[model samples]
Target chain A: MRYLRLYLHFLRFSFSRAMEFRLDFFFKIIMDCMFYVVNLGFYKILFLTTPMLAGWSEDQTMVFVSSYLLVDALHMTVFASNMWMIPFSINRGDLDSYLTRPVSTLFFVSLRDFAANSFINLLMAIGIFAYTLMNLKAPYTTGQLLFYVGCILNGWLLHYVLQMIFIIPVFWTQSSRGFSDFFFSMGVAIERPDLVYRGVLRWLLTLVLPFALIVSFPARLFFGPETPHLFLHLVFVTLAAWGFMLWFWKKGLRAYSSASS
Target chain B: MSWPARVVSTELRKILAYRSDFWVNFLGQTIIQLFIARALWQSIFESNGQTEIGGFTLSQMTLYYLLAPLTIKILMGENIGFFSREIYDGGLNRYLVWPLPPIGYKLLTYLTYSAFYTAQLALLYTFARFFLDDRPYELSEFLRLIAGLGYILVAAIGYFCMMCLCELVAFWADNTWSLGVMLRFVAGFLGGTFLPLSFYPETLREIIQYLPFAAFISGPVNLILGRSTPMEALQSFVVMLVWLPILGLAVRALWKKGNLQYTGVGM
Candidate 1:
């Protein structure tokens, strides 16, 4: 209840702040819509050339794209600004304020600024996801969809954890960007369907690095059998990833020598 | 060194100092994009048993993907923030006081980066000549490759003008970064970076062919691949030439208005 109250405060403050830059608010909507349009158009044109991509039909691909868009919109709304500011917070010693607060530093840092600008975009993404899932040929129970939604939320959490893993290096490297560039390069896997990747790349994206687990795993399982294998795998990976994130965050904080404040 | 030479030298040094960021952002992005494209296209071709789609064989498509990255690198360049950072931080005041033309200096900095990318384009074309094992580019194609570079230089300058117009909005708006983002998104689609304009409907393709975006990505790639001739590349250049003068005037007018509005206290 305390954390929820703190989050509500954050949402209130962020909305008030967003109202200051009215042009930026509108521009954010346009920018995100352009991105969504391009993503949908790219697949639309590709599907015209070939009926199937990675054994998934146009509608199935739409589901995958919409799911990724939802995940992205959720991230943008909640975590993206926080993660983007981490390097600066570390570099400028501003994180000391976060550390001194009574709240959990991780919670405060990750959730302080609710992106009210992206809330509308998030709604648009959810609409796309819903529209794509409608008139579906694939047979799945509401229980299955609830399960898939649970996995997708886990996928979003895993995305956060993975990004934090890349960003925690700012405590030492102080390289301005840390290792975030490499993280983004690998993030391409999150946009693409998992089956197109073959052999070692498949193993790498799915198992060791596990970027595909962010969206593809959830989408694939939605269409596939209601097997516990993938669900258990996702739950295990996400829990382990969160555990690693907490451990790494502690280690990074220990290593941090605060810069000029 | 002369003023222009000194500016170029400093930009080159900056590139060397942050070469890691350059590799990760530019080359890393290009490699991953090509990897995904290759995997996706290969699957489509294999499943459908179609060796060619939209006049591009698998090999030609690979070459397109390769060349397209170079075109993008030249256009986007190494500076992610570029001029907007200077304006936002009020560092533009320093350049304004300099006895040289500010726009000229900035343009020179932009082309220096493009020149480096242009050299990379040549090297890649040469590498493709020998190692595109299934169908190597012949010597005649190499001549066309030189002609194609001329068109690409035009595209780089053309895009620089467009971006300047975007960034110049910073004078009035607190954050003009979104304009740049919007420009890049539009360029990615309409410029044929994500999907070739050839794949669009006939009317759309024909209209976009006259637009600088298609000439930016597809025109140069097609010319080097022998899918287009120097004549066609020249025609694209002519189209770009029409947009150039108009963009130049807008940029000039904005800089003048911006200078008048400048309080020089970083807003």
Candidate 2:
């Protein structure tokens, strides 16, 4: 309950900071939208050449792109700005200030830098998602939307938990920027659909890293409803990653030799 | 005797003193580029067959990605925006007091950073060669590679000078870091750092073909990939030369205007 209040305060402050500069807000929105438009343009070009890539139809692929964008925006809204700051805090011992706070140090540091600019990105992602869904003319029941939202919420948690786990090494290494980028690179797998994988890669996606589960399984809820097993796996994986991140954070906190010394 | 040799030696000594952050940043940057390149390559493979893309085979594409970041480091990824920092903090005041002219001091600082960036690029290239798959080039190809590299070098200098002009705006704006970031993004996206401009529509590509950003990275990468012949390469070089002097003049003009209106804030 206390943590929820802390998170709410962080979100409120972060949103205000984003809106602090009206021009910055509008420009960022336009810029991000232009980037998404380019991706949409890429898809249009590809579809003109062929109906499908790697065995998925245009509508299916659009859903894949939409899901990736949605998950990405969700991650940005919740975590990106904070994750990027971890390095600076570790290097400057600013994490120490957060540590001394009344709230959870992890929660404080992770949620402190709410990116105001990303609100536009978030809205844009939702708009694109809606357009894709409408184009597909897919049936939308309240139960389905609820489950879709639930899976995406779980997906967002999975992303955050993995990020925290990857960044935990910063406490021990004193610098983890390289590791962070590498994690992001590996995390790129989440952006593609799981249908694209085969054999060992499929098993790897399911069991080992589970990058495919991030976008694919949640998207499956909408596009491939027959895949109930994947949705269950998504929940399972999210819980497992959440547990791993919590364990790692605890161990990392013990190893944290405050930067001042 | 030459200006570059003189600046590079002093810069090398200074860079060595702060080598840890330098190497870490270089390695970190390389890793990010590699990942992005890998992701894009995977996408391309998924979309198209195992054929050449914009005249590059899969292995060659990876090689281009590997070299692109190193090329960026060599050309324009240094302290290209140091002028903005100096303008913001009134560090330009020191340059004004020096026996060397302020503009000359700024240019030397630019050269110094470029020197450090070159060393860092070399380190990254060494690391890349270990892990990345690239085809061997013939003697003639190596010559063309040199010519292409020259194009990127001049283009980087021209682009950096233009950025220095943007940084000079710090003399007027309350903060220009966002502008700097926006400018870099323009350069990166338009210049084909994120993805090649070749991927754009013919009309858009034709228009960007003339823009300063295309000349920065894409033009050179295309040249090195043997996508353009010597005539086209020479034409690109001519375009860069034309842009360089214009940007240099603009930098001077902005600096003069900024200094006149300088509030000497937060010095």
The top-ranked prediction according to TM-score is: 1
Local distance difference test, each candidate: 0.82, 0.68
Candidate 2 at residue A146, lDDT? 74
What is the per-residue lDDT of model 2 for residues A17-130, given as tens digits with 9 covering 90 to 100?
766666556655665666566556656655644456555678877877887788778777778878988877776677788888787787777777777777769988999988
Task: List the DockQ of the predictions in order.
Answer: 0.58, 0.19
TM-score of 2: 0.80
Model 1 clashing residue pairs (backbone): none
Cα displacement (Å) at residue B62, model 1: 2.1
Query: Could you tell me the lDDT of residue B118 within candidate 1?
Result: 89
Number of the predicted model whose DockQ against the real structure is largest = 1
Fnat for each model: 0.49, 0.04
